[model samples]
Target: MKIKCSKILQYGALEIVAIYFSLLMVMSLLTGNLVYRRSQSLLAAAIIVVLTSHLYSDRRKYFITWGALGTLLASVLYIYYNLNDSSQVYLAIKYLSFSLNESCLIILTVSMLWQRTKKFILVLLLILALIIPIVFWGYYLSMDAWFASDTLLAVMQTNLGESKEYLSDYFTVSGMAAIIFIVIVAGIVWRNMQSVLLVKEKKHFTAFISLALLVSATACYKTRDNLILNTGWKAKENLQKYADFQKMQAQRKSIVRLNLQENGKQQGVFVLVIGESQSKDHMSAYGYDKKTTPWLGEAFKQDNFIKFTNAYSCHTHTIPVLTYALTAKNQYNELQLENAVSLLEVAEAAGYETAWLSNQIKYSAWDTPITVIASEANQQDWINHNIGETTVSNAYDLKLLDSLKSLKLTDKMLIVIHLMGNHGSYRERYPRDFAVFSDMSSEVGSYDNSILYNDYVVSKIYEYVRSLPEFNCMIYFADHADAVEEKLGHDASKFVWPMTHIPMYIGFSERFRQKDAAMVNILRNSQDKVFTNDLIFNIMLGLMNIKIPDIYEQENDITSTYYNSDIQRFKTLYGQRFVREDLQ
Candidate 1:
């Protein structure tokens, strides 16, 4: 019944190899990485064969029996904990599962190699353990780099330079400390094992040594692929193709010039407000239960404000939507803006002083095409004047008004105001006073509060415009609608109509009303079901009283009755595409 030291070493080696193999399989399964799974399986099988051979030769029952039992229990616990979905600790357990599985492999490897040529194998495993963590950290760094810059910087508190500095500092200190600790522990274990091992025990240690080599090899391979993908060399090539497509399409379209028939006939001002992340379902003006849009509702009841019932954003995200909306295109697939121009550029060409005021952060604007147009037109101005405790509060729509007041409003000018409306986490977007409904405790309630704050901000802007004598006309619509209900813990991936549905409003001054009553009624009664974003170029042409180009004449005009039916059929066929191309 007595155990030989050599037999004990063999049994321990087999147990360790089995535990390591199990952990590798579990890690691969949990991470859902096919590459890792295939590589680990190859290495795990090699380790298992070497260890099992030694186990069969060993006579001692105690070491092999107890070690096998312990391995089984650990593997079972790992699988069970991960499978339970209802538990609150599920996410925490999932995050730590990979690390825990790796630790189990480490423990098994070290224990099995404790008796034969123990000094050498112990030292190797220790150094290898340190390398394993460094490799994992490198993978994390690579994945972070793969994501877009806007996404990465959005979560960080510091500016770009400071954020990079922080990440670099964290990696250097943590990596060095972990490597040093592993080396010191290995040295101690190796020295102690040297004093205790017999010469006869040396052959049995080969099994454990092979297991250490297998793990090190797999980690290095995975880390190498991770680094390559993160460099984004391929993504840049794809972007170039998209840009080329846009440029080529623009060149194909013909340009038509407009001339003023009579100078100083009747000067007018127009303010176009572009809102972000607003849903029509949350607005009281759209018949929602919450009084989020009380002021807008009252304003609509008066004959001044005209509301469009079925406006929708072309895309879900800002970059794609704005690119298409401003360029007179739908998505990046088709380029229609060859000789075409943005409404702002058109207005400027018509001898109007144009200005673009925005509450969005300066960097976000700089990253997009809208800012490029703003810069080219020399009408750039940001309204992020407040720098308070909360970053979100500093850039609300009200700050845009502050910037607007400083500008000189001429009789013939066009002002574009871009508002940051109802972007989430909804609670952070609004003030505490906007929390009107007492029963609203969930994410939906927070969204309601955000909508209320946006309504208040819109009312404030409308009041400012109404008080100004030079400002005669104002047009307001959301840049895109949001997934308000889905954002409140529901499925957000399912694209719904309400997610894209937006509200459009137009207000005319007394002077404009009296002078252009016939034209005003034409716009008001127009039953056009045209895509809202695509109407930008044509509407601008109509407002300026310019002759329509060959391209424009071919497309549906919002001012005509025939235009309405054609747009509906177009919408039914190509959806947004017909509007983007035919209309442009």
Candidate 2:
């Protein structure tokens, strides 16, 4: 059967566009993550196919066969990208765009290579068939999570014995079935190609090659900043990142000198209590109608204890917010996370012994930047032994206090306590005795009860430290809050006021407050200022009175006299949306 050039162009271009949109629309509806911008990219790709349709004028059979195959390959890759669980909608769409671009590049490269030499045709078929096993593994991973750079990094860290065990666990009956299916499909495709032998007959050169280049250029242009989401690209990128992290780890050994100018305390027990999913709106000390924070309410009466009413979290998630909060990276800064200096490193540099105590899990299957930072501390204790986001534990925040008590005392100390306060499964967060709002069976009631329990835990920590002879300073802050009204946690996609409006407080011993009266007064006055958690790194330094001139921006330090509160324009989610707009 013979097909006209006009018919080929009309059907080929139209079919490609139709299939692209149909896959995108179905995946978008299923995942509920893709945004409108992805559709624009897909449209651009379809337009490139239409404009470059004349390239196939000379070789109709070759064009039709390769075009159909490329579309199928692209669709499979698109579905694989959407399988990721934690990726943002914008990022998911970007990954989908990369899949489209990758498929186009594969078609262009393979066609050109086969046209030049017929010997590697069978080899190409084998390589193409290998995609089935790769996709099957991806599908298996998506049942729990999806492939990421961290996944590759985890595999690299594992021993040979562990790797063998891990592979055997996933090599199920279905996996074997997929392998068999791909072998049959590859045989059929190879036989069809052998029957046609179209590459031997292709004689036209200039027009086809010109169109191919234009199509490749279009694909590259549309794939800006999205990057490839496949395992191979991610592994290469993560290897570079891991290398950079190793450099940062090496940099942590040397002592960094700071000219405090006779202003900060270098010898005392400084306690930083990091709360979880705790919103100021639900706390009595922050003017909630309920007595969710009764202990804090009483503590507010004392001159040493002060609460920052307008403080917020930089981001609406645990990892990103804490990553910035515990480092020099701020919402306004252009500093890369890998290059940023963590609080533990700074404390160690200042000649203070640092301890990290957490009620959260110690390890994740993927890369845990928090765990990396936490491990840098001189002493570390993690109460929860569960793995990553997949598992949940009932380890109470009080366990952190027990861990803190077990640590050996040092003269100059920095103790960081990470509490599991009010993180999802709110009912499970508190003890039976602390379920004060049990009579009221609403989600808000459960959340308030968790806050009540957290209040007790914070007060107990304060009580324990106050009993100590060494001058003590305690600062309590949450990573981010929850939006109970919408039944959503701190999801970046669903931005809300409660997610950022976290609870924050600082208390000093009488002796220390008398000595550092100037710093205490500055902090007291800045209580009402619009403070974000990202600026906490500088403030912690200020509390310790360790002044690294280059690293510490006084404008970002709440304890500094020059602290700026004019950052009403500061935004979250990498400055995509203004946080002030969500502030009620």
Candidate 3:
């Protein structure tokens, strides 16, 4: 009796050890000295697994094995399908692996509790694991129509519209056939899983459950990856952060009353273009060796255009940089930008019809930071997909031309066009005919070609507005620039000069600068001044001849006579301080 009790204790200890190591593998940062929270929970679950199997006199662990395998396969397929575009393939793989690791943790934990859960409950769990990929089909399907990568910001709160945004694109005969094939394969895998986990003996069932838990946990921790994997169970974190961030943008009031003035004809159009992953260093207009931007180059030569030589993005990533670019926020007053009226709000208040047109994901804006600014635009519509990042797309920027044509000419109108300009997997950005740069390797050549294509798109937009009446101006700047060579691409941990030095120029119609010659000179004189994009909110206001209250700083505005150019005050997003020469 004494010997049996000791052996039983040893058996329990081994089960606990397996779960403990597994927890450590996924969560290396998880620290616990005196107590083991994970160990206790796991031990309890293991005991439940044992007792439940014994009570049922069942040798079958159908739920555990089948569910885990199904989930594992589902997760892998989901990732393969939805991976976003990355200039650095390694970064793409790294994030994919991280997300998969979290799925494994879920699988293991779920497997251990399968039999303990009711049959109906288990079925629900199985369906959930199976459906995650389908939930993304909407975005992926539309992507094939024209597509690319996007992040959590792109996945607004279980939005069915977003989930099925590409349904029509994927439901074609061939697409339906592919879906049928997947369903068949899934059925087979689940059936096989049942057979594989079936046990004829009760002892075999208990031992298998215990050993499987222990072995899987230990092996996971023993691998080269140092930290334990995070569960990341909370799926809507980005949506929540977006909500919290927006309240700050709408709620804060710095002035007793808002005031705005239209410096030009209140009857003209102002187009502000927000470009993605474009760098000034690569643009011909900015004097790169390659003529990557012939259209912009010609525009630069025109006296109506004022190109800035030292403009920087506030952050290297899209969300952070654009949050400030579209609103009145900077690196210093992050807290204040919250509740600050965005450019669209100001434009609307001034009785302008605001329109936002993007070749990016639409559903992402519903709950992300982009929504606040986009909400200001009466015509803001999504034109892209939240599909996997690296998928090739033949969709061209010119597709937006039709939409722009529809807006027609309007008085006191503000149009914002967001382009998927020169983002990675660059070959997909342009049609094969646009591939003009030949001497360089395909990677670099593809990038330059995308820029060239961008030049065409920008010129088309300029020509359209050029035909419009009154004092109209067209402004183009990148959300943030990319270092095409960096392994993590532009969102690297450290600063690289090229990543923040994006192309920015105000292309005024012949009529716009003529409205006030002194205004043009003020815009031209501030050309060489060191500017950060976070000041875009203020810049947008100033360009429209809108006078902000005395509260907001004027130094960030290019059109302000008081625009600041103290070399000492300039700083990049990565905290590197620079002067005029440093920018060069």
Score candidate 2 by TM-score against the native: 0.67
lDDT of 3 by residue, 268-363 (tens): 788999888898878888888998888787777889889998888877767767877876666655445445567777777667788988776454
Give per-model CA RMSD: 11.7, 8.9, 9.6
Ten residues in a row with the worst lDDT in model 1?
A: 144-153
- Scanning candidate 2 in windows of ten residues, the lowest lDDT window is 192-201
Point to the candidate with the largest TM-score.
Answer: 2
- Candidates sorted by lDDT, best first: 2, 3, 1
Error of 2 at 56 (Å): 15
Q: On a 0 to 1 TM-score scale, where does candidate 3 land against the true structure? A: 0.61
| lDDT, candidate 1, 1-584, per-residue tens | 35687776776676567655655555445544322323443344334333433422332332333233223322332332343332323222222332333333444444455654556666566565444334333323332221222222222322443234334423455445644654565455444433332223556556655554465344333333221223233334434433453454323322323432333444677788888778888888898988878888898887766777756666555554565565545432244433445555555656678888877555542343555556544465776543222235465567777887887778787788888676555666677788876696666787778788888887888888878887677878776676666542111122445556678778888777767677678767852354455455555555555443442431444554444434434331115333334345
lDDT of each: 0.53, 0.68, 0.60
Of the two candidates 1 and 2, the one with more favorable lDDT, higher being better, is: 2
Q: Tell me how candidate 3 scores on lDDT.
A: 0.60
Candidate 1, superposed: residue stretches over 4 Å from native: 1-266, 331-340, 364-366, 385-395, 488-494, 527-530, 546-557, 560-584
